[model samples]
Target: MNMHIKVTTDDKDRALLAAIQDGLPLCERPFAEIGKVTNMSEEQVIARIEHMRQQGIISRFGLVLQHRPLGYRANAMVVWNVPDQEVDEAAKIITAHDFVTLCYCRARRAPVWQFNLYCMIHGQQRSIVEQQIETIKSAGLAPYPSKTLFSLRRFKQTGARFSTTPENERRLG
Candidate 1:
């Protein structure tokens, strides 16, 4: 059964959300640092975030690395046309590799896109990324048909934004 739960956010919750919308600061005590900006104690910040997560207000908290600046210039999305029944097992094998940064499955749009299982491989050089793909293929995905699409450009990536009003905007100095 599908159920919808409504969660209300107070002023403090808004402040906390604003403080972390750009991602947490890189510090020994990141929550403590956020506490300073939101005017809440470190424990309050952590507790509120946890409460928000349990309430389904915050679905995910993840890191977005700048691959280009990190020398990962060659990025490829390897798509595989694996049988539906085998997708989960194939994804498990693909995600086990340290080189594979992202792996997921999408529904195939028949007549055009036959591939469903997708994984990302990032490396400093194109050859290295290609070799990594070969290694992955040998690791058990050899029988499946696949294609590698190299990324030519990158667009800006950021976490979800909760508010856009001036009052909800809080930045750490």
Candidate 2:
């Protein structure tokens, strides 16, 4: 059986991680640029990131492209009332799909919201998102009713800043 491993790092490692959390730069030699500021060579930086990933300090790295800027703006949270035993299987199928960016299972409250499996899908138009939902339903998932909730306004979006020390005690290096 597989087991989890915990990562313990110093303040320097925390700072290095913080520098990378914003997403990698788009320019060529991005690691070199980052290395200059972090006092690490490009190869060292790359190797550290790889080590962190291997040790489970970081789940994964990704780029967050602005879909709206790319002209693919329509987005919605699609939820389904998946069977308890099949929730994991259904989530795998949903997340494995190219149209899905986010997929997970959440607690369900019947009558109000029976949806247990949720996925976020984005497309160029609302019709396309709806069509994807139709395909998902037609894939023999009609037994579990689904609902589409489109985002109206993005009020606030934030991420956690992990630190080796408590917030009040941390000082700039």
lDDT of 2 by residue, 56-115 (tens): 777767764666768777889998888899987777667666888888778988678788
Kindly provide the TM-score of model 2 when superposed on the true structure, using C-alpha atoms.
Answer: 0.72
Clashes of each: 0, 0
In model 2, the Cα lDDT at residue 18 comes to 70
lDDT of each: 0.86, 0.76
Q: Write the per-residue lDDT of candidate 1 for residues 121-153, one digit (tens) a residue.
A: 889999989999999999999999999999997
TM-score, model 1 to reference: 0.70
lDDT of candidate 1? 0.86
Model 2 lDDT, full chain set: 0.76
